[model samples]
Target: MQNFKAMVLLQIIISIFLFLSQASSQGIGDKSNVPEYAWLAGNWSGNGFGGTSEESWSLPSPDGTMMGMYRHLDSMGNITFYEFLLLDETGIRLKHFRPDLIGWETKEDFVTFEMVRYNGKIIELKGLIFKRKSENEMEILLKLRKGDVVKTEVFTMKKINKLK
Candidate 1:
């Protein structure tokens, strides 16, 4: 009887802990403490990889999620690839796809990028950086790593919409 009571108490404690943890995560996922990146909500086009790169970010929703999309066209103006991005207080989650919408990663896999810094003017992810140059110009610096070789690729983007 004593062992049964102890087990029941332990289970209750574990349940409470799990509940609190989940609640905390939800709270953090909201805008309670996340920086304002709404300025990024617009169409932006850039040049890189010998092609033109276009990206668009949506305004954050009530649930604190911002959706972003990216596509690159070759110098000949042929579509090359696409990327879908999900942004939240924690970081950015991204997935790659071919022009046909076929995924580069498995359905269960995505690339996670943690924010290194964000100060309204600049946002830095683990291996990527977004720096606002002016009201309508932004620069993107990406660090590409392979084996032991790391290369930096820079993209200069101009916001397509009238600056808000």
Candidate 2:
């Protein structure tokens, strides 16, 4: 009778372990679903804050990674600054680069914005948010802070071309 009780207890423990393992695996698999914001994959241009800006985005990969490049040009069409962007399950990462390929951040450091929320057309990433206004239009809101001063900027983008 003692041997039978021990065997039953061991079986129950094994079953519970298997169940927990399967549940954890499923939760991880769900993160790979491509975000509906994939609609951002395209060439976009706009004028804002005294400059003309152009941005290009790539469609999200199966693993939920999307890449983007941005250029800010003066009214005379001279390049002012550039930015590289990445979106993934971890969050949104941004790095500023000069026209000469010099990076603003250290080789091991980049700005990260944790994803706070998302719907089919809008994604909020901490202080930065993006909203798809329509098939050809989008809006970006950025909140910047320096010591005790805070500033907010809004940019409206119009689709210039769709990604192939």
Candidate 3:
């Protein structure tokens, strides 16, 4: 009777161990590939000189890919432009499409992006970089060049009680 009781206890312990082992083996999902900008994985509203713009970002898929779409409108509430961004193993790419430019403009915009090598408070992606200053605040820098002139603008986005 004692041997049978010991056998049952051993089996129970083994089953528990197997369950825990399997649970741990199930990866926590790779956050390494997730950039600082990942915090933007929701709806955002902001305004620039041009006008107000809204954006929406979604979580990365199982394969580690993320994308966001943004809409731009003038003070008159007319759709001025639309843009989208994609981040993947190859890096990050932003495509801007408006009334004047199509796919051809993507190449030119890509070339103007100035990429920084260091991962300081921010991570660099082409011409834009996102710096995580705190849990709720982030700074984004965008670089643009026209002719021989280079210009950069920094935009700070704060969480405003909305998630999409």
**Candidate 2 residue runs with Cα over 4 Å from true position:** 1-33
What C-alpha lDDT values do all the predictions have? 0.86, 0.85, 0.65
Give the lowest summed-lDDT range of ten residues in model 3: 111-120
Q: Rank the candidates by lDDT, best first.
A: 1, 2, 3
What shift in Å separates residue 29 of candidate 3 from its native position after superposition? Answer: 5.9
Q: Least accurate stretch of 10 residues (summed lDDT) in model 1? A: 28-37
Q: Provide the lDDT at 90 for model 3.
A: 55
- Where does candidate 3 stray beyond 4 Å? 1-37, 99-121, 161-164
Clashing pairs in 3: none
Q: After superposition, how far is residue 58 of candidate 1 from its true place, in Å?
A: 0.3
Predicted structure with the largest lDDT when compared to the true one: 1
Can you give the lDDT of residue 107 in candidate 3?
64
TM-score, every prediction: 0.76, 0.76, 0.62
